[model samples]
Target: MRIRAVGTSALMIEVEDPLAWFAALDAARTDGRIDVTDIVPGARTVLLDGVPSVAALTAALRDWPPPAAASVTGDRLDIPVIFDGPDLAQVAAHVGRSPEGVVADLTGTAFRVAFGGFAPGFAYLTGLPWSIPRLESPRPRVPAGSVALAAEYAGIYPTASPGGWQLVGRTDAVLFDIDRTPPALLTPGRTVRFVIA
Candidate 1:
């Protein structure tokens, strides 16, 4: 792990495993060990925003023990999905399985929100058994609530937008709502499971 200063008040910690670091940093902030305003997670980094003293945090981090393995300790949400997408058969073919088999495998896996990007409330989920490639040509628009997969991540489209991920299903769950206290439903560390609608 490497901690580097980002501007005046933020420190970006680059790690091989962002989830573990994120959980550790979040716990530190909650327990009053770190007076940080925000902990933003990325593909392989955790950005500590609004720190009062970067030097103090950096020194403390050096003395801290190695972070524990990250666990899905956040809210667990079961999303009801209709496993009938245009690319369902294609995904099955890529995995060398029937559509039903693919659905079974997906529903059986426990996914965790790694980070949020691409759009509001759109989370890049982790826990796929293997990596999958994106579509050669991205669709002009993917409807909201579309459950899709790309690379090593699974995600849901929070709004109708152009995307390249392979769509495998659709859901009715509200991923984002401005009125909601926590606008995004799949914040980092949350657990998600897809169930047949």
Candidate 2:
């Protein structure tokens, strides 16, 4: 693991495996060892914001053991989706599979929330191995609950927004709500599953 300064009160911790690092951070937070205001995870980095001191954070992490393989110990959310997106056929053709085959492939695998970005409540989920390219021309606006894939990650649009991911389905799950204690339904390290409705 490598630690670097981020502006004034933030530290960026880069690790070979970000999920493991995030797991370790979660454990530390549960044990009341991490006092940072926010912990944001990326593909392979964790940004610790509002840190009291870099030394303190480093000291805690130094004694923390590396996390085991990706495990879904927390809540596993099941999202029911209807496979009727405009790009469903195109995605199936691009992947050399029928629409049913494409849906089967997606539902067969378990996904984990790797990180949240692009928008609020928008989680970048990992586990799907097949590569799906982004649209050459992005849509002016994609509706909320749109299930889409880009590169190697699958995502659900929390709200209507302009996007380029190839949509394969849509769900009715409320991914973000201001009144909720946690505004975003998906967080790093959470387990997720997509199912046909």
Candidate 3:
């Protein structure tokens, strides 16, 4: 738990794991009186953006201790997915499981927002059992809402873009919409449970 001055109007909180950092940042949001514009969680740091000034923000964070953050509220979205991806067979073969089994295993689990990167609203969901191999090659164009898996994480393509993850299914969850207030279905530390429907 370290705070660094970010010019003016910003503070950066560094932590070992970004997911853990998210927990702390959300806590600060509830406990402090600072207006945060953005909280960008890195692998080992959290960038707290949009503040009044550096000196004031630094002083404000001094009172903050890394404690358990309140559970972030995430919309329980039901996305109907069609489990049809080219990598379906490959992923199952790597794990010595059938493709149907892979789908079943994937759908039954819930995930959290480890961080947000790779693409807008794309939660770098960790805790995907932690034994899967990282993607060898990224696809040129992964369709929007594509369900994918990688080492220790599973993700959904918020929008159609290039990505490097094992595709399993496609969801219709509107992860990002400009009209929406936050414009994302997943937020830091928010639980995400997937269903086969």
The model with the greatest TM-score is 1
Worst 10 residues of 2 by lDDT: 64-73
lDDT of 2 by residue, 1-197 (tens): 77887887888988777877777776777788787777888988988888888787777776767677655657888999998999999999998999999999888878999999888899999987589999999999999999999999999999999999999999999999999968989877788889899
TM per prediction: 0.95, 0.92, 0.82
lDDT per residue for candidate 1 within 43-149, as digits (tens), equals: 99899999999999999887877787888876789999999889989988988989999899999999999999899999999998668899999999999999999
Considering lDDT, which of the candidate structures 1 and 3 is the better prediction for this target? 1
Measured with C-alpha atoms, the lDDT of residue 118 in candidate 2 is 87
Q: Rate the local accuracy (lDDT) of all candidates.
A: 0.92, 0.87, 0.75
For model 3, which pairs clash? 9-51
Stretches > 4 Å off in candidate 2: 59-65
Worst 10 residues of 3 by lDDT: 69-78
Which predicted model would earn the best lDDT?
A: 1
**Model with the higher TM-score, candidate 1 or 3:** 1
Per candidate, the number of residue pairs that clash is 0, 0, 1
What lDDT tens digits, residue by residue, belong to model 3 across residues 47-88?
888876778777866776665543555664455778887788
The 10-residue segment of model 1 with minimum total lDDT is 65-74
TM-score of candidate 2 on Cα atoms, chains taken together: 0.92
